[model samples]
Target: MGSIDRYIFRTTLASFALVLVSLTGVIWITQALRGIDLMTSQGQTILTFLGVTSLVIPALVLVISPIALMIAISHTLNKLATDSEIIVMNAAGFSPFRLFRPFIYATCVVAVLVAFIAAYLAPDGMRRIKQWDAEITADVLTNILQPGRFAQLDQNLTIRIRERQPGGLLVGIFIDDRRDPKERVSIVADHGTVVKNEGGSFLILEDGNLERFEIDKRDPALVAFARYGFDMSKFSNQGHDVALGIRERYLWELISPPDDDPVYLQLPGQFRAELHDRFMSPIYPFAFAALTFAFLGAPRTTRQSRNFSIGSSILAVFGLRMAGFACSVMAVKSPFAPIVQYLMLLLAIGVSLWIIIGGIVIEPPASLIESINNANARLLRLFGRPATA
Candidate 1:
């Protein structure tokens, strides 16, 4: 690469990195908020909250990288145009394709990043998130250890602890259970402790009394007990052996799922769609960079502004991306639908290359420019200023 190529490559890569991080951080906060309950209500630590939330960053990057690349290329080209660097380079015998080579290099770099994340990092992160969630749900003590707050462990079960002392002692424990249709049970205990073993977890209550109310009877039956064990195993097994979603599976797994896999066997189209989507994801950065450069990187006269070109590029990129998304969705219903995604990407790349190599300059139509000028003149006249001729 020449010195000019290196300069543009560095500027574009830096801008892409900055935009990628900014966008991912903003989006991560929104997504992480949904998991805040793990800290606020579930008595989990801040580190735990961050760890679980950070696992989704790889997936977010996979989605945001291509958009960031487009923005970065546009910004770099705009800067060059505004500074007259592009005009100077063009006059110095630089072709549009030559000017775009640095951006192509940057795009290749981003494509590799996307490919790594899509094929490996994203799936691994999702798997970790799933495992973390399962562990959290199975940790019955974490769910019920919040003192002075009623922890709803199940739809019909709630537990509250007044205070917790060192050495695993709990004081003033209250339990409510209405899971049974025929009766409701409430237990008041002076002290309690949780015990776990191979059999499962148990909430052992001491110096407590149980009150049982039959649905048919008005009066309640009461029984006093010196020691009682309430089965807490049910909470741990609530979502046992849940199947992993398609997004959580590795790329190879998606391509060749086991015949016994229930989801793939039942909905084969989904697996097919996912397989193609993963393979096609890395191609977007190259296509997006090419399209943006073709639309905005060509040299234009000093009298022309590239605002229209910028807008057109944005619209075209958005349309192409949305079409790919739609194709993925359609592929879930029809096995042949994912072919459209490839076709659209290929068309974008091919058309953009043709335009760039052919020295095509995208400019606003004369009629539109005239209309804008006339509107500005009328506004100036209304404001008591002379209209430009």
Candidate 2:
């Protein structure tokens, strides 16, 4: 690349990085909040919370990188135009395609990043997150170890512990079971420990008394035991492997799912749509950057600002992306729905490239511009201020 290309590429890269990080961080905090209960209520440490929550960043980056690149390109081009750099380049015989080369380079870089995340990193992260969540659910001690809080394992089962000792002992354990419609059982134990085995998990309580009462009868039967084994297999999610969702599967797996897989047989359209979506995701960055450049890369000598062009570009990008998303959603039901995504993207790239090469200037309609100017004049008059045409 030439020096000018390097300079523009670096500027766009810096802006893109800034916008990507800022947007991703803001969104990550909101998403991470949903997992905070793992630490606050489940007794997980801060590191565990951070580790589990950070896995979603790859997916977020894959979704937001294209939008961030578009914004960065628009910002860079606007800065150049405001300073008349683009006019100088045009006067020096620089074609619009020549000026856009640096942006295309940046788009290629972002496209590769998106492709990697979509094809590998995102699925791996999702799989890891699922495994972590399953492990957390299996660690029953973490859920019930929180003192003074009732942990509901099921709709009719609740457990509370008064305190936890250093030696993996639970003190002052209380269990309420109302799962049976005809009876209710309550148990209080002075000390207990959770034991896991091939059979299942069991809560072994020592020096505890159990009270059972029938729903129809007022009388209760009570029994005391020095040691009691309570089956807790139902409350724990261990030993059962979780099935990976379509999004959690690798690209190869999506392309060739096992014939015996019920999910594949039942929802073949969804699998096909996912495969197409992953392949098409990387091309969006280039399309968006090209569209932005076509709208704002050309030099204009008009005294009026380019706010209309900027807004139009933003609206066009948003509409095209939304259509692509809709296409993906519909592709889950109809096999041919993903074709719309390809058409939308290709059309955008083609139209933008044609406009850039033909040196066409896209401006708002004169009537609309005049209407806006007249409205601004009226508002200024109402405020007793002068308005400039």
Candidate 3:
């Protein structure tokens, strides 16, 4: 690569990284805020909370990277135009396609990243997070049951703890079980720890007294014990499987879902849609780069206004993405939707390539430009400042 190519390549990639990180961080913070209950209500430590929430970053980056590449391209192009570098290069016989080579190189780099995240990293993160969340929820006695508050572990069973100490120790424990119609049981204990083994979850209570009241008898039977094991097998998910959602499936899983998979059988259309979406994810960076270059790559005189070109670039990028989203949604119901989306993307890239290759300078009509100038001048006069023609 020549010096100019390397310079442009480095600049665009640096800008892409900056914009990608900034946007991903901002969006991740918003998403992490929604999971703050993990720490506040679930009594999870900050490390656990952040670790679980940070897994969503790959997914966020999968969506943000294409847009970041477009922004970086636009910034680089504008910088070149501002310094008259593009005009000088053109005068020296550099074609539009030549100027675009470095941008495409940078786009390819970002496209690979987006593809990796979409195909594997994002889904893996989602799957791990779901499993982690299930594990946390399964440890109900330690995580969900808070101190000084009565927790309804089951429909007719309530448990309370006065103080929760380190090492899974629950001090001043109380339990009221009315699950059976023929009997009611109440228990109070000085301390307890939850234990799980192959036999299942058990709450081992120490220094506890149990009272059982039978329906046939008015008086209750009371028994004091030094240690007792209360069955809590129902609260544990160790006996069951964790069902994964469509988004949690990897690309290969989506492509060749097992015939007996329950989620696939129930929502096969979603699986199809998601598979196509992942396939299309990497293509968007190329499409966005094409549109950006088509709008802003042309060399223009200093007298020309680039405001219209910039606006058009934004609109084009947004329109393409919104169309892609709509198609992905419709693909869940209609098989033709994916085809239409492919055609749409191809047409966008085709037209953009045509413009770039043909050196077509995109600009508004002269009458519209004149009207905008007049409006600006009038506003300037109102502000007591003269406007340039």
Candidate 4:
């Protein structure tokens, strides 16, 4: 019994690991292609980009593990059937469900690991990544302007650079800023650089021009060019200060949001959506696992189950899981939607159990077997092989 348990456990675990790694790799490659733009924009090193991308895997694994688990468990069981191990066990009077116990145990362990990542590690890592992005954005904004090109640093400010030298000096600069309606000003300079003055911070325009536009024609404009100076407001919106809602907050904080939390008010829909997602997503794994077994283990075949049950189960699981995720968006806002999702999940569970446990399919017709054999023969012939006797 101990050896059997160990064997089942090892096989199930290996299957789960294989599925997890393969799925993760697919998701990782797809995301990496898209993330390259971000990495390039921020001028991130390969290592930094990899590290940042790794931070999101916890959330991805948390999202995907259950589907992978279901597929893994189903494949393992099906493999046993193909290898005739299931037949040997049945002949020895071991109940059909006796095989699924180790898989269930493994699923439980997977659930725990998933919960930890979803609840804690992912959110923290996301926050750190966001912070780094903010820093990168600030650094870029401060120094990314090119000489002799019209550049808009931000809203209400357009700067034209004549030339920027190796000694960090900006020569022949034109600045048009309309940040303040009451005091819109424009300045042109022969040479200048952002430097700390005795007072605070000021832009010194030398040997160039300054023109302040006036609304009324009677109110004449003022132009000056003798190294005049103007104060520049260091408006900084650091990303560290901006909480990226569920991405940055801990599970507890997401569940019990603080009253003064700006994220809740600023983007209420997104906030609620993520909150509901985290809470509701766990149910999918159990739902899928049961569905897989329910669909497959039932309609058992004496020789080989040539039915489309395997393909059908895969489609059903994929469709149901996708529907659940799509519905989650609207479900979060409405109070009764979550309840409906839960009820539907429960119904699926009961259905799966009824099919698997209640001995659904029994003694399928010989014609069914002949049709399957014929189809297999055709398939083999198409691939240039002989049919079976």
- Which candidate number has the best TM-score? 3
- lDDT for each residue of candidate 1 in 245-330, tens digit (9 for 90 to 100): 89999998987789899888888888898889899989999999999998998997668878899999999999999999899999
Estimated TM-score for each candidate? 0.80, 0.80, 0.84, 0.69
Off by over 4 Å in 2: 143-160, 163-239, 385-389
Q: Candidate 1 deviates by what RMSD? A: 6.4
| Model 2 TM | 0.80
Name the runs in model 3 displaced over 4 angstroms.
Answer: 142-158, 163-172, 175-234, 377-389
Candidate 2 overall lDDT versus native? 0.89
Task: Give per-residue CA lDDT, model 3, range 316-357, as digits (tens).
Answer: 999999999999999999989999999999999999999999
lDDT of 3 at 220: 97
Report lDDT (Cα) of residue 125, candidate 3.
98
Span of 10 residues, lowest total lDDT, candidate 4: 231-240
Per-residue accuracy of model 4 over 11-129 as CA lDDT, tens digit each? 87788889999998899888767766444443346776677677777777887788788878788778777777776876776664665566667767777777777778778878877
Candidate lDDT values, in order:
0.90, 0.89, 0.91, 0.69
lDDT of 2 by residue, 1-389 (tens): 99989999999999999999999999999999999887656656688889999999999999999999999999999889888889999999999999999999999999999999999999999999998898775566765558888998889989999876543577899999999999999999999987878898899999999999997888999999999999988767777788888899988899788989988998888899899999999999988998999899989865857988899899989998999989999998987788778988999999999999988889889999899999998988899756689
Residue 3 alpha-carbon offset, candidate 3, angstroms: 1.8
